[model samples]
Target chain A: GPKVLQIPSHQIIDMGQMVTLNCDPVSNHLYFYWYKQILGQQMEFLVNFYNGKVMEKSKLFKDQFSVERPDGSYFTLKIQPTALEDSAVYFCASTGGSSYEQYFGPGTRLTVL
Target chain B: QQQVRQSPQSLTVWEGETAILNCSYEDSTFDYFPWYHQFPGESPALLIAIRPVSNKKEDGRFTIFFNKREKKFSLHIADSQPGDSATYFCAARTEGADRLTFGKGTQLIIQP
Candidate 1:
């Protein structure tokens, strides 16, 4: 079975601070995605990355948000000048190709005060 | 547009009973549907899935019934157990796409 790993299971940060969420996707996966889920809400797609470039991004992905897969290492999502509304569970998912099945990581719970 | 919608925000059933979770989608282009289950403090895992071309797909106690014309689908859990208590999400993706649009979710409780 394939697995995706996310670091810093839970994080707490003050408003206006910077936070970086890390994800280690499945070894052979070619596509990476980021999703956000608020309390008692649906999981929303934030962005998808492939071949070192962003393929698509939702409107919720703001200017403060950025993603990168530097040197074929961990895929990172950085949010600078975080706002209170940024508090939520950020999930990382990966798939071998463009398919319906996407393996998800445990998720990084971010709390902004 | 909200692509996927699920009914009955929550459900409670006795062990060994059958639990049915309903889902509907508005995107006609959606050809793939998957149901994901999530326990508290854990990420969602795929339970079962079906393609629009098929009317039903079953794997053990989990079953997915898809109606292509109506754009509706449902998940049926047979012989439910307390361990099956969790949140289930209905997701859809169009062909040749990797992004999945998920429904709000249904919290199912299988009481012992």
Candidate 2:
């Protein structure tokens, strides 16, 4: 049972502010992903990163959003000048080579006011 | 557009009853289907998964029935218990795809 850890279980920030969500993916996992879930809605894929580069991104990944692992450290998702609609629980997931299973973190609940 | 869809937004099943959750996808190229269940305060954990190469996958009381021709699949929980109450999400991804398309999840309630 691999575990992914996310910092800041909950965050409340004013609109137009910048927020960074940190995720410590499973130790050996190489692929990282970020997903956004509005309350009672489906989880939407925002982006996926591998080898320090973005592999794919969805429309939901706005221009204000960015992601970086920073020299094999914690994978971080940053949103600058956040909008009210950006308020949602963000889950980080990771998996190793050739494995179809992606283990998800506890999720960081970002609330924009 | 939703690539993955699950039926019955909410369901309540009595103990010992079988609960069936349906899911379908719009993409025919999707080769992997996985079901994840989340408890009240926990992250979604992989419950069971299946590939198009098989029509059925069984793991203890949980089973996945896949229909590649119809682009549909379903999860069956037999002899349900109260602990089985959780939100179940059906997801799909194509081969070599890194992102997963998830359904709007089915909230399952096991009535004792």
Candidate 3:
């Protein structure tokens, strides 16, 4: 089974601060994605990245959010000037092809105060 | 606007019973449906999936019943056990789409 690992299982940050969540996806995965889940809510898609570019994004993905997997290293989601509403669990996922099941990481819980 | 909708936010069933969870979607282009299960302190995993070309998909005790005309689907867990208690999420993927639309999870509790 393919596994996606996320660093910093939990993080507490102040509002407006910059936070970067890291994800280590399956070695051979080509497509990467980010999703946000608020407490007791559905998981919402944030963005999808492929080939060093963003393929698509949802309304929840504000301008402050960005994703990158530089030099075939860890895929990272950077949120700058975070708001209070940014408190939620962030999940990272990866898939090998265009239409397939995605393997999710053990989400990183971000708390903004 | 919710693209995916799930009924019975929570359900409780006795052990050895059948647990039926329902889901519906508004997008007609969605052809791939995957049911995911997650437990406390665990990552969400794919339990089963079905494409529009099929009417049903079963894997062990987990089964998915899909209705393309109604734009709905459901997951049926038979012979439920206490270990089956967890949060189940129904997700939809449109053809050639990169993201999945997930419904609010259904929390299932199997009482022994």
Count of residue pairs whose backbone atoms collide, per candidate:
0, 0, 0
**What would the per-residue lDDT of candidate 2 be over residues B4-110, giving only the tens digit for each residue?**
98989999999999999999997888989999999977889999999999999999999999998898999999999999999999999877778889999999999
- Per-residue accuracy of model 3 over A1-113 as CA lDDT, tens digit each: 88999998999999999999999999999999999999989999999999999999999999999999999999999999899999999999999994589999989999999
Give the range where candidate 1 chain A is weakest over 10 consecutive residues by summed lDDT.
Answer: A94-103
TM-score of each candidate? 0.96, 0.98, 0.98
DockQ agreement of candidate 1 with the native complex = 0.78
* Candidate 1 Cα misplacement greater than 4 A, ranges: none
Position A82, candidate 1: lDDT = 100
Residues A17-72 of candidate 1 have per-residue lDDT tens digits of 99999999999999999999998888999999999999999999999999999999
Q: Which parts of model 2 are misplaced by more than 4 Å? A: none
Instruction: Residues B22-94, candidate 1: write the lDDT tens digits.
Output: 9998888887899999998787898988988799999999999888888899999999999999999999986
TM-score of chain B of each: 0.96, 0.98, 0.98
A1-113 in candidate 2: lDDT tens per residue?
A: 88999998999999999999999999988999999999988999999999999999999999999999999999999999899999999999999967889999989999999
- The lDDT of each candidate is 0.93, 0.95, 0.94
Model 3 stretches with alpha carbons more than 4 Å out: none
By summed lDDT, the worst window of 10 consecutive residues in model 1 chain B runs over B92-101
Better of 1 and 2 by lDDT: 2
Instruction: Evaluate residue B1 in candidate 1 and report its C-alpha lDDT on the 0 to 100 scale.
Output: 64
